[model samples]
Each structure stands twice: as C-alpha cells, then as structure tokens.
Target: MHHLGVSLIVFACVFCSAVLGMYLHGRLPDHHLNDESMGVVKLTIGLIATLAALVLGLLISSAKSSFDTVNGEVTRDAANVILLDRILAQYGPQTDDLRVLLKQSVARGVQIISSNDRAQIASLHTLDAYKRGETFQRKLQELTPQNDMQRRLQARAAEMADEIFALRELGLLQATGTTPIPLLVTLVLWLCIIFCAFGLFTFPNATVTIALFLGALSTSIAIYMILEMNTPLDGLVRVSLGPMREALTVLGQ
Candidate 1:
C-alpha cells in the first residue's frame, strides 16, 4: 500500500478502537468498571504503550540513518563520475567515444532518479543498465594505451567505473523498503489497544473525542514519515538529486 493509505488505515483503526471502547464502557457490567479492574487495565496498557514508543523510536532512527547513507553515497558517486570523465579526457582524442558513452550513462541515471517513479527507479536496477555498464567496461578494457601515462589513466578510469557500478547497485538495494510489514502491523495493533484503553477509562465527550482524533492523526503522520524516509528514492522525503544532476551538466564539456 501507499504510505498515505497505510497511515489512513492506522488512523481509522486507532480512532475506531477508541470509539468502540467507549461503547463497551456503557454496556459493560458494573463490576467490570471497578477500581481494581481499571487499575489492571492501565497497567497493561502502560506496558504496551512503552513497547510501542520504543519500536517507533528505533524505526525512525533506522530510516533516517538509511536515508542519509544513501544520499552520501550518491554524492560521492557523482564526484567519482566527474573524476573518471576528466581521466578519460586526459587519455587523448581516442577516448572521445568513451567520454560520450560515459555522459550518456550519467544522463540516463539522472533522468531515472529525477523522475521519482518507482517503476523507472526499479528499471535502473535491472539488467538493461547492467548490460550497458558491462559494455562500457568491455570497451574501456579494449583501449590500446600507447604510453605509460595513457595506460595509467585507462586503469584509473576503469577502477572508477567499477566503483560507480558498485555504488549504483548499493543504492538500488537500499532504495527497497526496509521496514517489516508485520512489525508495523504489530505496532499499529498496540496503538489501537492503547487508544481503546484511554476511552475505556474516560467518559466520551466532545473534548475526549477531539483529543483521540488528534492523537490518532499524529501517530498516523509519524508512520507516514517513517515510510517516506524508508523509500528515499521515490517519495516526498527523497534524497537530493542535485549532485548527480550537476555531474550530468559537467559531462562531455
């Protein structure tokens, strides 16, 4: 499901659970509403609440860390690309075609990343890009270096190309969703139980309902943010494309 849809479902489950608890409050036997029963309920809910909060904190931290790592990798890859192009340029006019191919590859990558379409982003990880990269590598290896300087430049360019390819694969793997669905479901379930406990202990009124509504909405938004951060390539909280785009502009110049 889309992040927003998942969030909405969370909100509905939480708020409705609270509403259901309120209904049960009025219908339950008088003994069930005793002080001892209420105390036990609070204690159980407290434990669940603590667990939920811890899980949420861990998820947010993990998502943010993943997002930052990918962003840094992309920036580093862009710099490497520019460096490789310069090396090829220094190798002489014989590398002109190689330089053009390098630019095209970068341009294609920039276009795919900028689109923010999941399908297009997935395409980047597919065999098509891999084949193109292999072809580039094969051509680079076929170059006949006439002197020591040209030979060294060719070797450096090949190394940089391999590094770029590895980084690309790493980024694509990171772009895939990292959050476990079952974990999220369990968290939402805990939240719903907590909210229901809140309603069970309090009388339903406009003020209580509004408070529950806001709480549910806030929780949903938090989940949404976590999901967005996990998908840094195709969502609102995406990694910046400025580095790669700038590199594309510098290519073939």
Candidate 2:
C-alpha cells in the first residue's frame, strides 16, 4: 500500500479504537467496573501494546532485511556471471562456446527469480541444459597449452555459477522465514493492538460497543495491509521488479 493511504487507515483505526473504548464502557452489563479495575486493565493493555510494538518492529526490520538480501543476491549473481563472461574471453577459442552458454545460463537464472510463482522455482533445464560452465571445465582439462592461468580463470568462472545459484536459494529462504503468513505474526500483533485499545469496554455501563467494533474493523484492515507488505509476491504490495530489470539491461549491454 502507498504511504498516504496506509497512514490514513492506521490513523482511522486508532482513532476509532479510542472512540470505541468510551462507547463500550456504557454497554458493560452489571460489571460495575470500579476505577481500580479500569486502572488495572489500562496497565495490562499498556503492557500488551508495548510488547506488540516490539514484535512488529522486529518483524518489519526482518522483512526489509530479507528483501534487501534478495536484491543483493540478484546483483551478486549478475556480477558473477558478468565477470565469468569476461574471464572466459581469456581462454581464446575454448571460451567462445562457453561464453554464449554462460550468458544464457545467467539470463535463465534471472528469469527464474523474476517469474514469481509464490512457490519454489521452476525447472530451468530447458535453458542450454544449464551446463555451459561444466562443458567449459571439461574442455579446459584437455587443452595442454601453456595457458594454465587461463584454465584456472575458467575454473573460477565455473565455480562462480554454483555460488550464484546457491545465493539465490539462501535469499529465498531468508525472505520466507522472516515474513511467512503461516507464522501468524501479523495477526498476533494486531490482536494486541486492538485489545489494548478496546480495554475501555471494561466499564459495566455498556456504552462503547459500536465504537469498539468500528475500531476493531479498522485495525483488522491495517493488519491485513501490513501482512500484504510482508508477503509481496502473493499480496497487494509486490516487491519491485525494477532491480531485476536493471540486471537484465546490464546483461544485454
């Protein structure tokens, strides 16, 4: 969600909760809540809110970190591929076929990430059998020219492919670990915030029912939005594809 819209919704939620607490107090039946009980409830809600703040803060931080980690992985993979492409050039004739293969493999890796299925990656064996580097390594072993340095460089390039692929998996794991919906992190945080604000209903007079419900509804919506931001691949807030596009553009250049 955009900043302005999210802000307004959050504001409305809190405001509605404040209004609700006042109304719910009037609707409380026979529970003549003394100031002592109200005070205790207030304190309890305050503590809950404090804990919720801590959890939400940590989750948001972790989500942002995961997103950056993925971005970094993509960039690192691109750099590895590009550097390998350049190093392959030193192999002269042996590198020719491998360079094209490296390019295609890197490009396919890029496509896998960009193609988000909200699940595991698709099989990429269709792209040049995804073994240009392996082929290059085998060919280098047979060439007995005084190009040991070039052979080593080609080996490094081949090593880079594995590193880049592994990094992608690392990033994917981190991203999902931090913001998984199954964890119910968002729902937990929202429950605390709503309960804290609805504490005003503790009064026995029963006057705040409508206000409390409105506040609850609004707060629920806000939580849903936060959840969406946390899971962009399948939610309303999708991770930007700009970085991936830039990687592709650089590869083409």
Candidate 3:
C-alpha cells in the first residue's frame, strides 16, 4: 500500500479506538471507573506508553540512519564518476569515445534514479545498468597503452570503474525497504491502546475530541515519515540527486 494510505489507516484505527473507549465509558458500571480502578488503569497504560515511546524512537533512528547511508553512497558514486572521467581524459584523446559513453551511462542512471514513476524508481532496471557497466569494463580492458604511464592509468581507471559498479550494487541493495512490517504493526497497536486509554478517563466534548483527533493525526504522520524515509528514492522524502546531476555535467568535459 502507499505510505499515505497506511498512515490513514493507522489514524482511523487509533481514533476509532478512542471513540470505542468513550462508548464503553458510558456503559461500564460506576465502580469499574472508580478511583482505585482508574489508578490501576493509569499505571498499566503508563508502562505501555513507555514501551511504545522506546520503540518509536528506535524506528526513527533506524530510518534516519538508513536515509543518511544511502545519501552518502550517492554522493560517493557521483564523485567516483567524475574522477573516472578525469582519469580517462588524462589517458589522452584515444579515450574520447569512452568518456562520451561514461557521460551517457551517468545520464541514464540519473534518469532512472530520479524518475517520478514509483514503478520505475522501485525497479531501477539494475540488470540493464549492470550490463552496461560490464560492457564499459570490456572496452576499458581493450585499451592498448604505449608506455608504463599509460598502462598505470589504464589499470587505475579499471579499478575505479569496478568501485563505481560495486557502489551502485550496494546502493541498489540498500534502496529496498528494510523496515520490519511486524514492528510497525505492533507499534500501531500500541498507539491504539494508548489512545483508547486517553478516551476512557475523559468526558467527551468538542475540545477533547479535537485533542484526540490531533493526537491520532500526529502519530500517523510520524509513521508516514518513517515509511517515506525507508524508501528514499520514491517518496516525499528522497535522497538529493544534485551530486549525480553535477557529475553528469562534468562527465564529458
């Protein structure tokens, strides 16, 4: 499901739980809601709340860390692309065709990564990109050098190309959503229970209803942000493509 859809569902579940609690409040006997019972309920809910807070904190940290890791990988890959191009340039005019090919490859990569279509962004056509990288490696290997200097440059260029390919593969692997579904489900369940507790003790009124609504909405938004960050390439939150775009501009020069 889309992240927003999931978040909306979470909101509904949480808010409905509160509404259900209010309904029960009227039906329950007075003794059931007396100070002694209320005290126990508060203590139990407090423990649940603490556990929920810890889990939420962990999820946020993990999602943010994953986002940063992917961003760094992209920046590193862009730098490597530019460095590879410069190495080819230094190898002399014979590498002109190779340099042009590198630019085209980088452009293709940028197009694939920055595509607005979720289907395209999710798939990334990694196989095709890998094939192109292999072809480049073959052509790089075919280069004939006239002196030790040229030979060393050729070897270094090959190594850099390998590193670029490795980085791309690593980035692709990391791009897949790693958030555990069960953990998310458990967190939402905890939120519903907490909100239900909120409604149980309070008298219903416009002000209280508004407060409940805002609380549920805010909780859903937090989950939405976490999900969005988990899939950095295809959501409101995305790794910046500036570095790759800049590398594309420098590729043929």
Candidate 4:
C-alpha cells in the first residue's frame, strides 16, 4: 500500500482502539481497573513503546541517509554534464553539434526527473539517456585531433561521458527502491499494540482521550515523514533541482 494510505489506516486504527477502550473501561470489573492491574499494563506498554520509538528513529535516520545519497548523486550528475559540455567546447568547432546533443540530453533528463510519475521513474532505467551519452562518445572518437592537447581533451571528454552514464545508472537504482514494506508493517503493528495497551490502563477521561489521540496523530505524522523522505521525488519533502537548473543555465551559455 502507499505510505499515505498506511499512515491513515494506522491513525484510524489507533484512534478507534482508544475510543473503544474508553467504552469498555466503564463496564470492566472494578478489580481489572484497579491500580495493580493498571501498573502491570503500564509496564508492558512502556517496554513496547520503547521498542517502537527506537525502530521509528532508525527508520527516520535510514530514510534521511538514503535521501541525501540520492540527492548527492543527482547533483554530481548535473555537474558532470556541465563539465562534459565545457570539455567538448574546448575541443574546438568540430564538437559543436555534439555539444548541442549533449545539452538536449540534459534537458531530457531534467524533464524526465521533474515528473514524479511512476512511468517517468521507470524510464530512467532505460537507455534513452545513455544513448545520447554514447553518441557523444562516438563523435568524439571520430575526431582526428591535430595536436596532443586536443587529443587529450577528447579522451577526457570521453571519460566524462562514461562517468555521467554510470552516475545515471546509480541514480535510477536508488530512486526506484524504497524502504522495506514488511518492516513498516511491523512497526505499525507494534504501534497499534502499544496504543491498545495505553487504552487498557488509562481511565476513560477527557484528558486521557486527548492524550491518546495526540500520540497516535504524532506517530502517524512521523511515519508519513519517513515515507516522504524515502520517496524524495514525490512527497512533502523532495530532492532539490537547484543543481540541474544551474546545469541547464550553464549549458545555455
């Protein structure tokens, strides 16, 4: 299921469980609602709550790390695009057509990545971008430079093209993958259990109901944030396009 949907379900389940607990508290035997029973329930709840908190923290950290890594790759790729274009420019007028194609490829890349659609993300895995890089390499290869300097520039440009292609491949791999769904499910289950325990122990009062609601809401928001960070491209938080936009400007010059 989508992260947003899962988050909502979690919130609803916890909220409903709290409400049900309040209703049940009125009918339960006095002994079951006694201090001793409540104490034991609280103890169990504490342990479960601690575990849930740790897991959630780890998930946030992991998602943040993944987001940063992918964002860095994208920035590096854009920088490489500009660097390769500059190299071709230095290679003399023979590469003018090749430079234009490289710029077009960069534009294509920007368009493809700007969209958050699943199909657009899937397209990243194909050779559409790589084909353009390959064309640049082929044209560079055909050039017969008159001097050592020009020959070296051609080699460097070729190497840059290869690097750009490799980076794109890595970016695609990272962008398409996500945090494990089963792990998230387990976390949500733990949260449900913890909230259920909370309901069992607490008296059904206004303050308790409000507290329980707030806790569930907060937990749901945290999960949503983690999911957003993991997806990066299509969420409340997204990877910035500053680097790509800058590259586009440089290409225009």
Candidate of highest lDDT: 1
- lDDT of model 3 at position 68: 90
State the lDDT of candidate 3 residue by residue for 17-102, as single tens digits. Answer: 99988888888899999999999999999999999999999999999998999999999999999999999999999999999999
Rank all candidate structures by their lDDT, best first, as comma-separated numbers: 1, 3, 4, 2
Candidate 4 residue-wise lDDT, 1-253, digit = tens: 4778878987998787777777777778999878998888888878888988899999999988988988999899989999988888888888888888888878877877677676776776667655656677787789889899999998998889889888878777776557788888888888877877777666778899889999999988888888888877665678887898889898835
lDDT (Cα) of model 1: 0.91
Residue-level lDDT tens digits of model 1 in 31-60: 999999999999999999999999999999
Query: lDDT (0-100) at residue 3 of candidate 3?
Result: 92
lDDT of each: 0.91, 0.56, 0.90, 0.82
Task: Give the candidates in order of TM-score, highest first.
Answer: 3, 1, 4, 2
Runs in model 3 deviating more than 4 A are 122-126
Model 2: per-residue Cα lDDT over 153-229, one tens digit each: 75676576567656655655554543454444454545545554565545423355555556556555655555555
Global fold similarity of model 2 (TM-score): 0.66
Could you tell me which 10 consecutive residues in candidate 3 have the lowest summed lDDT? Answer: 121-130
TM-scores across all candidates? Answer: 0.96, 0.66, 0.96, 0.92
